[model samples]
Target: MEQRKIPFVIRPRALGNAILVLVIGVLGLVMAHHPMLFSGFRRIQTDLRDTRLIHYLLEHGYLWVCGIPEHRTFWNPPIFYPVSNTAAYSDLLLSVGPVYWLWRAGGASPDLALAGWMISMSAVNYAAALVLFRKGLGFTWLPSASAGFLVAFGAPRVNQISHQQLLPCFYVLMTVFALARLFGGNPQRFWERGGLWLLAVLGGVLQFYSGFYLAWFLMLGIGFAVAAAILLPPCRTVFLEVVQRDLWVILTAGLVGVLLLLPLLNHYLPVARYLARRQYLPMYYAFNPHLWSWFHVGGNHWLWGWTAGREPFRTLGYPPEHLLGFGFITPLAGAAGLYFCRERPICRLAAAVTLSMWLATTFLPGKAIALVASGVAYYCLACLFREFNGPRERAFGLASVLALLVLVSFPNIYLQILTLSALMLCSLELVRTRGRPECQVVPGIALGLFCLKVFSLDVLLIGVCLVAPAAALIAYYWVGRRRDVGLGAVLLVVFFTAVTTILDSPNVYLGALAASSSALLVSAPRRLRPPAWLSVRALIVAMVLVVWFYDQDSLWLSFYNKIPGGIGIRAVGRIVLILLIPAALGLAALVQSLEQKQWTLAAWIVVLVCMLEQGVTTESFDAAANRATIAGVARQVTPGREAFYYRPWPNPGWNTYHLDAMWASLVTGVPTINGYSGYNPPGWDGFFAVDAQSTLDPRDVLAQWERAHGLPPERIQSIGLDRTCEGPQQTRHRP
Candidate 1:
């Protein structure tokens, strides 16, 4: 037998770094070349006004004040008793807590400030991934890091989730990661050494911040965890022992996190009260008393929309894209992941339970998996891949299974062919590696494909197999077996491309920073001059805001119609790009890995998934309008005694293409209604369904609300407007 050395080009660590550079660079380049935020995903951008509120809350210590431009300065209102609305405050916490201080300390620009917030989220998410793989999945550097890729950059759909909602996804996914890792394998690593105690505390703490979504995923994850644990030789002992002994510790973690954070959270209870007072009637959803078909939805509908008079799309199966989702790209690979469940007993049960639930939720006529359960379910299934290796030399056998499944499930020829090819590659690789679950080249590739759904078009995902493998093989030959050198060269090129892109697209990023050495580029503002409309002090303060970072559709009519470009660029295109982040990262890693002469197998999977994400949404420049509205409203408000209304708050709020006047209150720490809080009363969805309405007479609803809460009208007056109005007099306007 000839013992052939295929070569060890890119080692694990270097491969990862290289791929990171490549992915980031690619995005950077795109950012530079076509720099309009609204070019494709106009609605996804932030409203500077709301962002200002985040800064304001951090700086002013919750002394609510409207920076109403009419008054020309921050001022108190005519009303007496203050209304403590918790909803706005809750929204603020989600946006401001993590990056508020950093923004202020750094003296950053709006763009930089926002970018900093995003970076923080990615970092926390990355940490969570580390915990899962290093500690839970028990994989080495490659697989462990892959968890972060899966969470932060893995699935393309993440981009479509509002920037704020990403936090919910982040925290919840973290807890589940701990669940899978802590309880999945090597229980002694955590439970024996206070790991169970750690998990309990982490779970509790995250669950508090994570909200309803955490609860949902917890139900699903626990069941899945139970299955995973049951399969384990040591799970019973660990689960029982940990649950019995460390339950309090875990509970305390949540209690303590909330307890400590509540003071800050309470700082804005008035805002929540404000949210609760209003209603959020959406169009897409309604309790179908007569027909369940009206509620029929695809698996991806974890979003809310302002309903018009139209009956919910009449359907029993998922909407077209959704029905196609399970069959996206490589149905075979997804099927393979599902089929692998049978190879291992516990694996089968967990897979069956999780995937079945995920499938049901996806196809369920409601928002079952929209929160975080869907994401957790997908990843948990990924972990059930113990069958790709071990006693079953069934890589080809299973690969055949996946191919056949894809043929049956998917009806789209382009996607079917593209996905089938990718799956086949993955299937073949599994055979070569003897099904060692550790090899990630194909899955990583698949992960890359999966990520494209966030912001780019799916059709590009097909480019992965073409671009990555070709580039990787070429790099390997040039660099020999040294993964470091190969990846370094590729990384340099990728970074240069990203930097150049950013430089070119002045509208997208500070090209100067990317073009220059990162060391020389500071995220904070270098100057402190009060330039135009802003006061010198305000300028200085704005320059020095401690950054803290980082919604759904509502009422999307307000969103789609109001976009800045007036609806030209493909909204789905934007989604595709952001969604591609994970896959891009993974593919870059693969390419970078091969450049460095490393061995990885699943790069193809990322490629396949990315291909499928393109067809998922209707991308457009609406994202620009959405973000513009957010930023625009922040600049419009002049703090003073003048009353205001978010007449068109959450509808546009959920998917901001352009920042509107509303942002000032939130950023400057003033009170605001109809921000991103879900505190709107129970009948909100129904309200929107009856009419494509943005305005409601606050007078009509106010008395009812105050009476219910046992509060006076003065309290509502002190906060702001009685009802969100779509009139000229409204201070914080949404329309």
Candidate 2:
């Protein structure tokens, strides 16, 4: 076989990579979350929800390791006073164990530790992206560095700085890179790569514990890589070698995660399993594409306001979608990879995983429908086989098995079903029709079922779904038939308008359809003369931009609603981050324009324009924005004391100020009755009911508290003026 010539071949050095990654991290911190480097990093305070909570958990974990027996187990975290295993109420998984200990060893304050972790993780994201592009895709340092910046500091991630746990996604990138290296070609010296494989699995395990949702996301990408490796003949031998060399690493990582999580499982398994079972459907619906567009960019990001004005973007104040934008040239590059890099198995695997993740993450219409259908089918099977006894039922019981699996292992259902169904469909079609056109009917029926299901739930998705595929087909044909540009433009407009008008949202389904269908078009017979080389790339970029634009509104919120002490940061950071997409697109234009020896200065002008726009729009969180100064009240309490709030600010359903009550517990290391989280311990409401209606009766209050917590009077304490008893002790206005 003739060796394929690769472009932009500058080999990256470790020192250069580290320096560039560090630069990206420093820039990320300065531009977005902590602009207080000059003032002092220690003073930077992020908002409550997860940031404060995560810090609290980290502090608790550190104290536990430093010989504080009460903090030994996160279960019954000296919060919500005697509420056992309340740490399970939030995803306080020990994934950040290393970060916690490192900060502890360094004697860093919780705030300082958090800031350091965030900045370092941002750098890790940049490095991982660089690895994926350079080592994985054979790209040179400059383009790879640009791509790294784009991925690591994109709008969605910038907005998630407050939700710190979700920020360290370099594991996903690293895992993808590892897979590329593993199966990119023949495994040269497979035995010697054990260390690399160990690092890969170690990254994966760390990701799994970091955040459950992000771990699942990474698993989805990994699933795609594995499927590609096994299914693609050219990669099969290397894949086997990789498995042979790395099996122990994979098992070791699994064992380590299990050991770390054992305590959590032993304490909260049944309760969590039950709660998840009850909340699964509602939670899924709340976050799914049916209620919200998958293309939703996010409401908190600054660019969201610039792209779509500050009207209420969501129907209700739903949490925004995760993907803000893919940067300008990303989709184009992905499409090009699919079209032009088929010969390289690594490129093919990377392209396939990236494309699939884009579609899946965006909740593309077909993918969503398939997901819903599979979920429905899974439950239906479980229900149908309910009467089967013992182990037999366990084999077919997807829901029950899933719950059990969560208790003992990390299992990703969404990826499993998606990958399995796709492979089955492809295999069946190949077997049944030998690649003939008639095999299309099988997928057509599946598509019909998906459409019917979505239509039943909401006709909007169906319309969007249908229009998206049609739009993709038109764009694909238009690429080959440039003479019919007018016709193609009209069709694109009609499809886009129909979906936008009907659904009142730009959706993922449409974009996914367009991209995948365009892939199919790559192999279609040529019916017309090709256009200018740059035109093809430009056309593809345009088509993808349309899709990217569709979801931008979903990225930022109206920010109209406000609760007591609710913190809302300005959208400047997100807006600046969004500009990175255009900047990257311009860079790509410059690179291409240089290659073509035309329009190079115009490309430079575009790049300059985007940078200028970002400079003007980029904003950082004010010190006061994230500050919750509960330290004055908290430090008054002595260590190992029981604390109670006198009618603590009633937690008005996610009212962030209520979180201040628990901040006292975290700081003082005192178990406090007043605390907050999504899943409160059982009897919490009844306990609150009594606490809220303050009637002066100490014995009654004590009895009620005892019953609520199932703990003795000595085990708890009423700190800072127990209002249940009217006296001078109640005179101190502690919070």
Candidate 3:
């Protein structure tokens, strides 16, 4: 092998690298204006109505936890209906545990309870992103940075914030990442960096408890692999052959979860069967791809918005697709990895996972489909970890393809620019496709079933997945970094930069970016050097402008327009604390390195632009918009009785406020007319379904609640919500 020169493609000039950091800092600034940050982070309204659901688990008394029925008070669960999912869901498991713990620890204040929920959700989301990026994308700084912003702040799962379902999904994403790391994260390490045997089992148990998707995912694919291995034997060798990596962990974890819930599951067997179903609304779940085009192209955020003013994405610091929590960039650089990656197994796995994710969204019902497909999101991030150190030939092809595809039909010009830039940077490395350990047959099969939309198969896959790891010795053989194969790095840069500039929002930073394009006018001027004074001066000015531009564009000032000095303080503080100005300054300095007409500078500028563009916001939530309108109506809950009535503005026996068996789940630690252990017993809907014509009788209400709920009196508290009754203290909840 002739000793060929390896140009430092990954290591841009010191100035250029500094610019990338600045751009990332600018993104951090953009994040400061996010809806979650300033909108007061209010809890969802539906959650507010079902107070008992949150409180019953607080464990003030043993009788309440046991499900003994109470009267008129909303101390019992609603009757289970075969038509819908009511009693159990993976999303509920993780939340229930945390809420219970928090309340028992004397943190029962509703405000505190809501805060804990949000914090936990945020942590889970971050953890999931970290796992997805580090393990799936091979652990690069950029992937990790982008993963945090992309996964937590991205547009796909907006409902996560609204519904509080994000935490469990985060847990699930983290589990997959951990598994990937253990199996093949480093060919250098045979297992995780530290032994994680006990941890793996615990994770498996949590995965099952958190969401039903994992269970269904496993059943679909893993079952086939095991059957093929046992019945065919021929394919057994094709999968993992190691003895230490077998099915024991998964089985053990699963058994633990089942045993833990055995008591609850058995006692409520009848109710369980009735409630073990879904609403099954196929038509209600339509995913129009055109919606993406509308959302991104309109550049205003929502699909043209119902109010129809200047769209939301247009005014924000970030783009609509990047932040509103909806769809995001299609495969992009990950598409290139399919052909260009040197770690063939990693590439193959990435392909399988990505395909599965795509299928999950297209085929499955409910939101879990998206969660299933995101399995590839982490895999793609892992692939981005590769860096350039070899031949630059085929390195940029996939990136080029992605850029071109986005340019052709991508509605938002900004997206085209960003996509092109992404593709360019992703192609900056030499990639190889070859051997690596950490492969497991179970996750692979589960991923496949996810795409196919076989919900039942998910569970079996987990079982098989746990066992497959046991079959292989699972050795690690990390590949050395490869350099780019024959390719022109500089030319690629200019082409992408020009594209992003043309496509992106016409903002002040862009103009500053354009003016700074002068720096690219002259690259590595070995013969003629521009004065150092000019570069530093331009850099300082650019940093200041970055901060000013962010504050002006954020328009959050508009919300606080009435408040004195809020905007001035927020903007000044943001410049230093937010980090956007620094990132932009860094990027602007790098642009100065390129010479005019030198397309290589174009490449540098374009990539910087892409990274910077990601930080921009589009629309935001209006704080003035009232959230609790629907659930705010007052419903009466007597302190010691089951009877209640509605009273917001003096209700005259109007049914505006209704109570239910499981109402406890929706109130402030007060027993409600709602809940469940098995299936909804019967007449669950009628608890809140009663007409005001009936007289409000405490004894009668307690009897009704007793019949409905499986709880006894002492455990239930008929706490106050509205003035349903005032005269006497009833003890219908007392045994």
Candidate 4:
């Protein structure tokens, strides 16, 4: 491949430009939140306010470092008394601990400290994106900068503001860069000896500290990459070479992160299991992706109203704010990026590997395989003995075998299997039938199966919309290359017929519209007679849309929508806006292709619009008065006094007192029973038992009180029960 010069004027190599990008990101975030930053009002992003758990974490870490005897271990804090190991509740030890200690020591308020730390992390995230794109990919400054901006302030970061785990994403980027060199055979700088292993280890460490969920996500990604290397001969050779050079570094770094997590795991496992038993499976399916949700413009933008209520999308984890995947242009940009990188075998392979890992992580393909295997085993057992006189036993057996094959096939592998199988069968038929027109029948059947496979999982959900564009791509390609049309045309016709049949059944009239639009693009190059690449580019974009459409797994297999009342279709629009990040990347590639100065500026302008309209950091936090009141109340409260909130905790959707308890605890240096955290302490139920009868019946309350105090029933009546756990207003909000 010939080396291409930087397409833009901006010198991406200059240290000053990188610094300027970072500065701009920081200043932009601060300016966006000027209402909270400039004023003395404390800033707490949306997620923090919803849980106030991080506030507790920051305060807990500070006192631990300060050597305050009572605050030494958050486990035995005055709040949530009897429930222990509060420190095990979150991924706070490394990410937020040090930052909180520094800011607290400097006399910043708890809310202010938290806000500052979050802002600072956002800046780091922005800078890291720039480094990954510019340094790792070797893109010119404009495209690299565009990628950086999208990543730093993109949907994932904005949606995960409360998570703290997702904020420190730079380490993950560094790790990816390392892997690119090791497996993708992407070149590294001369001074970068041992950099791959070092980055892998560092990314692991920081990822674990940043958030266990993201750490697991990263590990899964690494596992997939390793698996890919092992499967592909060329990639395997590269992997083996890297492994031989620094096997110990990889092992040691991985072990250190795991060893550090052992203590937290020991405490966290029981609670996780407990919650999993009740909520895991049901919640998992509930959060499945609704097909239409992907195209809806997110609520973050002013233009959201245009597509807001049109689709019913949903999620179980974060709201639409955090669930952003590639937005409306997912079909367009994803295809364009792939087409641009089509010549780079390694880049395509890496993308496929990463995407496969994400699918596996979200869908638990292993479990699906196991379930299918069990079903097949049962069928085989039945077939061996003829136990039941079922209708069409041969047909059942064939279907079962086919289902098993599909179940085990990974995402990209499935695409190859379908495409190759069609080609082989079609070619064999053509030879057997002596080049007769009937040879088309075999490929037609296979193409129909492919279409069926694409939509059978979720009738209209998951990449169903891609059918139109995909058909167009196939048709256009067939038209352009008449020599290959014999079998290809048969496949295209069969595929189109199958897709339109399904769409018509569901009354989805948009299929025809999509096909028409794609056809128009395919014809544009002929009519306008523009650049030679324009028509091909348009076809590629259409092809990408078609490929991506069938490539997606149905919502039934996804983890995001598992929980009951997860972000449902009504609220899923915003999450789809995240697609814009990749779309921006695609625009960069197009600009690079055009090599035009004006188009480059236009790309930057689009990024700026994304920042202004889609930005969420500004709206993440509540006003300063709330923080001030909580602080005031905390100061007046007696130090070392235990406190607990009412029966139920605050909800982001409804409740207003979410941050009150934690904020007061931080200010007063008192521990309280009413605390919100990811992990529910083992003894929480024992300490605050509330069955149906206890909340309403005085006698039941007394009985419960006596059990809690380990006292006789007569003594419970003598003690006033009303004072126990106090009213919500007095307990959570009082000074």
Reference-based lDDT, residue 253, model 1: 59
Per-prediction tally of clashes: 182, 15, 152, 30
Order the candidates by lDDT, highest first: 4, 2, 1, 3
In the range 625-734, model 4's lDDT, one tens digit per residue, is 66665764455455434333323222222123324655666665554445555545544443234332334533354345445745443321111124344332332322
Question: Least lDDT summed over 10 consecutive residues: which range in candidate 1?
Answer: 542-551
Q: Model 4, stretches more than 4 Å misplaced? A: 1-43, 74-78, 184-195, 228-237, 244-249, 273-276, 280-282, 286-288, 292-297, 313-331, 353-613, 617-623, 628-659, 683-735
Residue-by-residue lDDT tens digits, candidate 1, 1-735 = 999988757788887755753463334223221222324322323333333334333333222222333222222211111333333333334323446446645776444454455445555655655555455544345434443444443323332323243343455545555555444543554335355445544564555443333333444445555755554554466677656755665675556656755744554345434443342333112211112222222333222111111345343322321221212333333334335333433334444454433332222322322223222212212222323332222232233333433333332222222233333334334444543445745553443342232113433444343456756766767765445444333334333333343344443233222212221222123252122222222222211111100022222222333432212111211222222222222333332343244434454454334333322222223434444555555444445423333333223333221123334454543344333323333433322331244455444444454455465444333222324544323443222
In order, what is each prediction's RMSD in angstroms?
Answer: 27.9, 17.1, 23.8, 15.1
Worst 10 residues of 2 by lDDT: 563-572
Better of 1 and 4 by lDDT: 4
lDDT of 4: 0.49
Q: Tell me model 3's lDDT, rounded to 2 decimals.
A: 0.34
- Overall lDDT per candidate, in order of appearance: 0.36, 0.48, 0.34, 0.49
Q: What is the TM-score of each candidate against the true structure?
A: 0.45, 0.58, 0.44, 0.61
Q: How many clashes does the backbone of model 2 have?
A: 15
Off by over 4 Å in 2: 1-25, 42-45, 74-76, 92-97, 100-108, 228-268, 280-283, 289-304, 310-323, 326-347, 354-629, 635-646, 649-658, 685-705, 713-715, 718-735
